[model samples]
Target: MSETNRQWLLAKRPDGRPTEDCFEMVEREVPDPGPREVLVRTRYMSVDPYMRGRMRDAESYAEPWDVGEAMRAGVVGEVVESNSPRWEAGDVVNGNLRWADYAVADEDQLVPVDPDRAPISTALGVLGMPGRTAYFGLLDVGRPKPGDTVVVSGAAGAVGSVVGQIAKHAGCRVVGIAGADEKVHWLTGELGFDEAINYRETESVRGALAEACPDGIDVYYDNVGGPITDAAFAHLAVRARVVVCGQISLYNAEERPTGPRKLGELITKRARVEGVLVRDYVERYEEANERLAHWVADGVVQYRETVTEGLENAPDAFLGLFDGVNIGKQVVQVSDPEN
Candidate 1:
């Protein structure tokens, strides 16, 4: 490892959608590990829709990224030096390694990654935050039961895709909503979703929901909120559960977009709507990971990644999320280990 490393920093706050100019790449010396810390060489970096929120200076569940500081993200890397007895050189670990090539991680922050069950990268996608988001958000919050009708928006995305599959595995009749026809086909034909709707081409989301879910929607796992949420809310059955996982549609909006006026329906239907943060279930991550891994191993769950080849293309890769350019989890391969 070199004494200095190249890293990207948040140059300026983005007014609307983030552009390449907002990120500035610079070279900095590798930071030394303090007591109970480990130095990691990042191999893969995640570029997700949630990061768009952090770019704004406004208050959010998490702090905004500071100007001139390295951008943050969930990352997987190898420990090259360790100051703690809990880890040693050659150990692969995952944590909030941010968007840099090298990071110093605290002993309590990093988790070991095993390559035997699946690729180590799974720790960032299917077996990691996104997977846990789908599992707990749908099962725990949504409380889906056998024969329930479950509808998931952004069904082709990393989290929503898994949510729909897990719902099917739970014996629910699953319906997925995505942007393109191809994604709709993948969700319904290959992923075993009972039905899929391409929201972009569809004239009425509400009509589509009514058509797909003739029995009424028992659970709605919402990933891309906006008019789509309004449509799903309009069809909630009695005692229905709505899981608010994300609102990607409003992420790049200059102002909050108006949604359907359907609060009265909630009362009429005696339905429940709740927002979820996957971090709340950190204590049960091991259990979630085990089950998710089992599902993947048994061919009950499948995943995809729209990977960008070089570190320099990270900005473009990240921007693609807003334009529906990514088909699944968007990741940037900084450097191939075999290279």
Candidate 2:
């Protein structure tokens, strides 16, 4: 008898707004690690908005996954078998791995995770790429100043939640824009956002933004771009910094949707819109994790996670991003960590 590994593979390229049919589940005999590699049993897996971009046939920042091949994602796992001198059985590690029950990783591909420091799941959320994204996107790119009014779109998400809180810590008036009323309240209440607008309930997002940001938005952290972006641009103050973090709204559109021709406004407002990628600041991850962990401990920063039980539901969890289903970091619990 042989052990089997269950995996999810890309069934086909999506025409527009991928459905569950785009994914296929299969099982294969468990694989053994080669020299300098370790076999890991996955515990937690991450599903993010960026993964939507990967489902396309065209090239992008992330390499597209080939059809019939196992889909890859960020995962925290326990090393069950090791052929590398750097790792051993029972060691906890995390890296970009397959959406499967098990994965084989090279020594350099995975970094050690201290389970005692926090839940191992944090390796896939706040203490991971999402948190690093917020830290760099807000501090380095946005350059938010004290007394500045910072507005965060998708403010209830994994990255947006952190960005808004970090802005608050900077002594900025943090305004959040979310879809649901509870999400909006969560931002204004527990997250310490000065104000939050529920776009779904608002008659006009632009008008609501104008009212919330009476002084004009000094910093705009955009995650879900679309009409919200058009509205946010209209309320920018002089020399505003607009950080283009994620444009999740357009990720599923079959054809490009025409948007407001508002580039001309940048000339008058003297505003700067820049994109931030966490990979660009990979060398500074330790800096961010350390600072963020400190803030979480000091009650200055907070986080949340929406876990989808079982690896079989990973595709469903990923699709939920476009629908704004999850409140914070959306992850899948694949298995329990071995103590």
Against the true structure, candidate 2 reaches a TM-score of 0.98
Writing each residue's lDDT as its tens digit, candidate 2 over 1-339 gives 129999999999898899999999999988899989999999999999888778887889999888888899999998999999999999999999999999999999999899888888988888899999999999999999999999999999999999999999999999999999989989998998999999999999999999999989999999999999999999999999999999998998888877547887799999998999999998899999899888877889888999999988998899998889899899999986432
lDDT of 1 by residue, 1-339 (tens): 877877889999998888889999988889999999999988888988899988898999878998998888888889989999999998989999768778999999999999788988878899889999999999899999999999999999999999999999999999999999989988988789999999999999999999999889999999988889989988999999999999998998888865446889989999999999999998999999999999999989999888887777889999999878877688888866764
Candidate 1's TM-score reads 0.97
Name every residue pair that clashes in candidate 1.
none
lDDT of each: 0.90, 0.92
**Could you estimate the TM-score for every candidate?**
0.97, 0.98
